[model samples]
Target: MNVQPPEAYATYKTYSAQLLAWDSSFSAFMSLKSHALTALQIRGAALLKIHHTTATIMGRCVPDPTDPRSIVTAANDPLIFSQSTNDFQTVVSLSQSLVAAAEQDIQRGNGRLAGGLTFSTDMGVVAPLYYVCIKCTDVPLREQAIELLGRCPRREGMWDSVLGVRMIREFWGMEEVHRQLRQGMVKLVLEDDGRWEWSWRDLHNGGEGGGVGYGVKEMLESQI
Candidate 1:
């Protein structure tokens, strides 16, 4: 995808600030009422997560002076990197809180809504937890997200916790293989250019533009 224009960055910053302001106002309102609504809290945290994740990605963009949308590169600025890390930390915390809140809600529901068969049109905890499971760099936090996904098997819109957990565990296995390759624990045949060609054939075998065909549970078990 092409890089966003300079104006896009400015717009993003404005939106982020507005989101923060709204969250602060909501918090103050809740404090005054001496009660916190779980649904509203979840919605607020999810919105912040979306904004922060976008900010983290945008922080890596270094737009070209001549054509802002045509050229981009990873930023080398320490402050930008710090801000990205802080944003990611916020995502992690929000994901954890969402999972805890969902678990409590499930408990209070008395097992009526704990299974994968339960469905909801409104946004729920599954997507946020899945996002953290796939995006967070912190191992423990990712594991916690995955574990929660496995335990709570509800369906939120099109998001299924069971399938999400499977995908996340598959992702974990892929990350593990990449880490081993980087550490030289995996043998590799390098080309003349000293680059190893990694193929996705083993992961997906429905020919070009095909979805993953293997079962995630089987893949993870083989890794074990």
Candidate 2:
């Protein structure tokens, strides 16, 4: 709470670099310690959604004095909880902490860059774009996310555009995509030729585990 003026900025810079480098390797670094990352994801998601939907979220949110330590402990340790007593402040500080922790892991160096958001690398590469998308609240962060998606590297047959679209759609109403997919007469599918095509499915049969492809059917079906 009483960080020296220079210490916060220095810390931010250090962590920012780490956040930029998170990749497939990240998962391994977190293999036995993934509860920390999971906590970050859950807390980050809640705070980002609140900010995105309302255009504002309290800079801090005081935990109920009676709130169970187990719940709060998942996201903010006692140290963080004591310092960031507001929603917005907590979100920002947590972002910094996550980045710092990730960078430290990478500095120790030992992972692979195969898949997922936390890919590892022998090199010091980073993926700040994803961090901004999931963290930061200002206009610049949104712009950065859009720009990064446009230029993100591809793997196998999957492209950043596909994942980018998913992220964008999430910012909008996720349920709306499902509703449209169900009611619409046509479903979109990717062809062997790498072309997108449409198919007809019965809406009545559409839903979780019901339609042809409705597992996380709500989100994935939108691509159709």
lDDT of predicted model 1: 0.58
**Model 1: residues with Cα > 4 Å off, grouped in runs:** 1-3, 36-117, 189-224
Which pairs, if any, clash in model 1? Answer: 116-153
- Count clashing residue pairs in model 2: 20
Span of ten consecutive residues with least summed lDDT in model 2: 53-62
lDDT of 2 by residue, 1-224 (tens): 22235564566556545543542344455565546566446434433433332222212222333445543443333343244224434333444443444445455562121223342332111223333344344444445444534433332222244465467647644434445557674466765655654444556777432455332322133232
User: What Cα-based lDDT does every candidate model obtain?
Assistant: 0.58, 0.41
Compared with the true structure, model 2 gives a TM-score of 0.25
The prediction achieving the highest TM-score against the true structure is: 1
Which run of 10 residues does model 1 get worst, by summed lDDT?
A: 215-224
Superposition error at 109 for model 2 (Å): 31
lDDT of 1 by residue, 28-70 (tens): 7656753445665545646555544644445354543454333
